[model samples]
Target: MKPENPLTIGIDIDGTVTEPSSIVPLMNESFGKQLRYEDCIDYNLATVYGISDEVFADWLDKHGERLYDVAPVHGAADRVLRQWYKRHKLVYISAREARHLEVTIKWFSRYQIPYHHMDLIGSHDKLAAARKWQVDLFLEDRLENALQLAEALSIPVFLFDTPYNQGTLPRLVQRVTSWEQVDALVDQLALEKANA
Candidate 1:
């Protein structure tokens, strides 16, 4: 069946909209370690950096806003999101805490990223926010979040492929390699909805 007009699209900010490796430079600079994006086999930077969760949390407390401040936009996200903004309800549902909301908004503004609404739920579990927004579809980069959202919500989720997120996905979760692919998928969904 066709979805409602102006479909609410739940979008993750860090790895989905920004390059998955966006924090590498900050990490490398702070830890004095040279880590490539390929080296990040786990979603947890604490594991990748070989630090305790507490230490990692402290570092994030210090540098989290800065990290978001300088994160680069993922490939073609600005253009494609702008296009989608014309027709869809773009709702950025990020795990970033409310404290970082100002920085996040500034980052979006600095990059000219379009959005109809944004929420920084401060946790990795995005199911609540997604459901609250009544998202028809979701875009994500974390395998766990994508899986949970799809399975629980019974909504299609586009998972942005990353070195850390390598895994088999369920039927409702599709691994997308680029924003271009995401755009194509969105277009296909729109066509399907139209034809329905």
Candidate 2:
């Protein structure tokens, strides 16, 4: 549901707003594994690929920048987000490290993704940021994070569906597959709040 004030929406970046499989090609090339997005049932690539954490870290250190730089935006996200930005507070709370803030902002600018606030929290624990911002709703891709945020904040979370997150979700956590669905859901939430 919406609030009396403009809704503050907390959004995840990587697999949510960006092309869901944006990093798969890079990961495949880097690790010599031909894996598809549906094959990734876990968030940790190292585990999914059966590589050591140190090797994963080393690979990231070498290619992370390029990956982020070229990652594509999900279709219609720019238009929908820009529309929402006019009436709501769009807060991007990413698990990307604090050091990547500049590049992240640059990526947004490059892609023309509208946002009011950006927080590089460096981890998947986004509850604090959501609480701090008083986010009325959250859009996410990580199942664990969505579950935790919805349960902890007592708010609805629109989980962007991915193979990695295909599972039963709580009533408060709705699985969405497209930006159009997200926009419609937000409108429905606002209508429900207005009626309430």
Candidate 3:
């Protein structure tokens, strides 16, 4: 569905919109020391710290559908997302499987998150989707996701600052650790859309 003069906002799941980066820790605990310290999501999912790629993919196949069980990030970030829906079109893009689509959508509904679109994709190339949407701003937690979006020319990814995403911030991205910061971003984006 198209919106009338609505600002397109692309949002990432997992670390960006959710809490504790569930998939990574789950993969690490399941696969053991194989999946280590890799900031990039796809790479880590394919291999484990230079170990066997088969092991990582095998592990991902098992618990990949349980992504919705991952805990949420603290604060009223969902409130911010919902408020933005009042004025803009939010596209929730996740690197998850189709099996978890219903669960993911329910999770958002229970959290009262308002969104216009949702795409449950695998660990494939995400930049393509971001570019296809012509997203004005992207919000995510994974550094690799931010970088990919940035590289795809999707500037100004609103990152949810965390330990995993610290220090190595990209030049074209912005970070926000608190709900207040997200609120500011929502309001600013809303105003811009309204004015335009």
Task: Give candidate 3 regions above 4 Å deviation.
Answer: 1-5, 21-52, 192-196
Using TM-score as the measure, the top candidate is: 1
Taking the tens digit of each residue's C-alpha lDDT, what string does model 2 give over 1-196? Answer: 5435567899999888888899889999988889998898887889999999899888887887788788999878989998898778899998888888888889999988889899989888999999998999999999999999999999999998887887898999999989999999998887777677
Which candidate gets the maximum lDDT versus the true structure? 1
- For residues 1-196, what per-residue lDDT tens digits would candidate 1 score against the true structure? 3335567899999988998898988889988999999999999999999988998899999999889888889999999999899889899998898999889989889889889899999899999899899998999999999999999999999998889999888899998888888888888888787777
TM-score list, all predictions? 0.95, 0.94, 0.76
Model 1 lDDT vs. the true structure? 0.90
Ranking by lDDT: 1, 2, 3
Query: Model 3: per-residue lDDT, tens digit, 89-132?
Result: 78887788777878887888888887888877786467877777
- Cα deviation in Å at residue 72, candidate 3? 2.8
Error of 2 at 139 (Å): 0.5
Residue pairs clashing in model 1 are: none
Candidate 2: regions farther than 4 A off: 1-5
Worst 10 residues of 1 by lDDT: 1-10
